[model samples]
Target: MKHVPAMQSLTPAVDARYQTLLRKLITKNGIGGKDSTAFVDDAKKQKLKTDESSIPLPVFEKGIHVNQAPPTSSNGLNGNSPTDDSTSDLSKTVSSTQDDRANDVKDEIMRNVLTIPMLKYDDLKAATDNWSDANLLGRGGFGQVFKGVWLNSLVAIKRLRDTDARNRELIRELCLNQYRHDNILPLYGYSFGGAEACLVYQFMACGSLEQKLRSKSHYPPLTWSQRYRIAHGVARGLQYLHTMTGTPLIHGDIKPANILLDQCLMPKIGDFGLARKGPYGEERTHLKVSRVHGTRPYLPDEYLRSRCLSPAVDVFSYGVVMVEIASCLPPIDRNRPVPLLSDWIQQQARDGLDFASLEDRLLQGTPHSNPGLCREFVAIGVHCTKYSRGDRPTMLEVYKRLDNLEFPGKHYM
Candidate 1:
């Protein structure tokens, strides 16, 4: 791996370049990632396959949404004249509009009181053979996800250890119907009052990204194209969580283990057990806590110290994940002296270490690839993991720049 310059080597030119890059991508007018139709189109064009027995993506109303202000032109909905009966008609219209809004609010409340699909303990026992180790797919912080057949199709059942503490996640999942994005994993339902309190989801054909990265021998090393695509997908998912959705979600846990893969090798952000409804208006999002939930390396310093939870923590974790993906290495290897991929990469970059060699090291035998693109991505990761949350770019901005990145032979201006 290439070592960038240490902090001491950050010359004026390097700082200027970095600042210039950020300014170029982040326009002052508005957010950068609002228009990403091109990138979504490119992902659709990718024709990668994975090892699965005829897998299919669940259709969950992942439709296009556009949020715009009400029109202000005369003779429009707001236009009104007040003469004789005109005033009476306008009052009636306003009253009806208010009534309609009240009804919509009532409907929203009913939606939150959703009727979750319940499953009996007997059914889960039958499917998992009484929670047999043979059926266990993997374990999580608060539960273990078991692979089992449900209603003639495969499903992942996460058996929660603490139902009282973790039930909120299931509620959040249901509420995120307004927050649903294609790259986000869908929650099928939940089963409480059963022997095992659990949440159900569509089984990811290729499993978690962590599995693929670790078991390179079993699964081939992901090509640069694949990694790039995965990065973009993950970013869009985060963007949806941060901005696109009505209720902003702080995923709390953002790591490769939470990122699952589908039949086409596409990425899906999963595991909302630690998710929380983000702050709004003047509301403070920071939480005072004695305990923090997350992987050690991925947790930012602020999160550990003040327990001030924010979307920036997820962004920081994403930065670490980015480093891992680019270098095709784990966050930390105990056996190796220099552990924690993001720190090492950042230290190298700060020290003016030659980043040129990162491509050959990370990309391996891929003779046809884009090193410039890889370097730029690494830079983004470093910025995300910055010590100050104020410095990190919003998830939308991250997606915008990433989408604009050109592939090997292509040129864009």
Candidate 2:
């Protein structure tokens, strides 16, 4: 008689009897109950060991196995034993499957982020409150600008008139170098799939310098010191854009209306759709631009004559700004062929006029006004406005001269 295991007793009585008869025959064939039980238990233990060994170790975190292997029995219990080569092949298959799954997950994440939907035409209309007149910030040659809020971020959206391929290239270039300067309006992104093209930029709170300069009756007039700082900031920004290496950028248009101010009165240069880069393979020397851009009063005479422009063109524009700051006069008058402001300055310089009359009228009632300081500013202005571009000083030199000028006493008039 063979001692059968208790688990075998759970099987049907008839099957148990049959297994018992087979065990007896094996015993007769020189196999005993103890040897058989030992062999069965050994087979169970080996299968359990293989299952434990097949469990993969966690790669990233606990309980997160990357490649797990299937369980397989070994020994005479199943009448089949897995070969060492089969085990190795199973492991390679499991690893490859896990790798493929990981790659698929990575691809899915990248696709999701890259395909984030841009603003559609209807979406923009809704965000801008149906392009209401109340939301209008300003308008320019490109198109109208609007103040909009999206995802809690305030943005200035420029709705462009034309969406040609050239304009698209301009947007790409501007966006690429948007992070180059702190005093320039940065391009966040753009939308051009609809009937209108739109450019997005960081919102400027205080509007443009033109508004500030022309707002004598409404907002408080900017002081002399404030104007000087604003002018310095603008010069530094232009210098960065014009002189920095790796494809020099030429701001074809520079004017008061294009200079924006923040709440702290810091000036920021904007509107670069008309900017041009120097020719390739050529060292980024001064640009020889031929286009007659910028406002007439601010335009250098060389540019008017179609001479190739250099950074001096910007310096010439800065000189015009200096005159505006000094005299508090508008840059142009439609009624007059020549701007009264520039004509007056040229006339004064020719007559060897004194600096007293050039002082801004806003300083007339201020007790801090100093005639000597005014003289220094006027002299600097004269040097900047020299008829020849070669005679004009660089923005760096202009900044230093302005810095050296002494400010009057708090109560000195």
Q: By summed lDDT, which 10 consecutive residues of candidate 1 come out lowest?
A: 51-60
Against the unseen true structure, what C-alpha lDDT does each candidate score? 0.61, 0.58
In candidate 1, the residue pairs with backbone N, CA or C atoms under 3 Å apart (3 or more residues apart, or in different chains) clash, namely 4-348, 4-349, 4-353, 5-348, 5-350, 5-351, 5-352, 5-353, 6-350, 6-351
Using TM-score, give the best candidate's number: 1
- Show how many residue pairs clash in every candidate, following the order shown: 10, 1
| Model 1 agreement with the true structure over 244-312: per-residue lDDT tens digits | 644456787899999999887789999776676444333444432223566778877776654555678
List the lowest-lDDT window of 10 residues for candidate 2: 52-61
Tens-digit lDDT track of model 2 for 1-413: 22222112211211122233434444465554576665444433442112211221101112212223322432221123244564455445544443433443223322322332345566667678887788899987668999888667877887877534334333333333533687787766556456676766778898988888788787777776677667777877877875575444556567788888887788888877556543223332243221244566776665565333566777777777777766677877667555555565776788889876667677765874555656666676677777887799977788777656566432331
Model 1 stretches astray by more than 4 angstroms: 1-110, 113-115, 174-178, 245-247, 282-290, 334-338, 360-362, 409-413
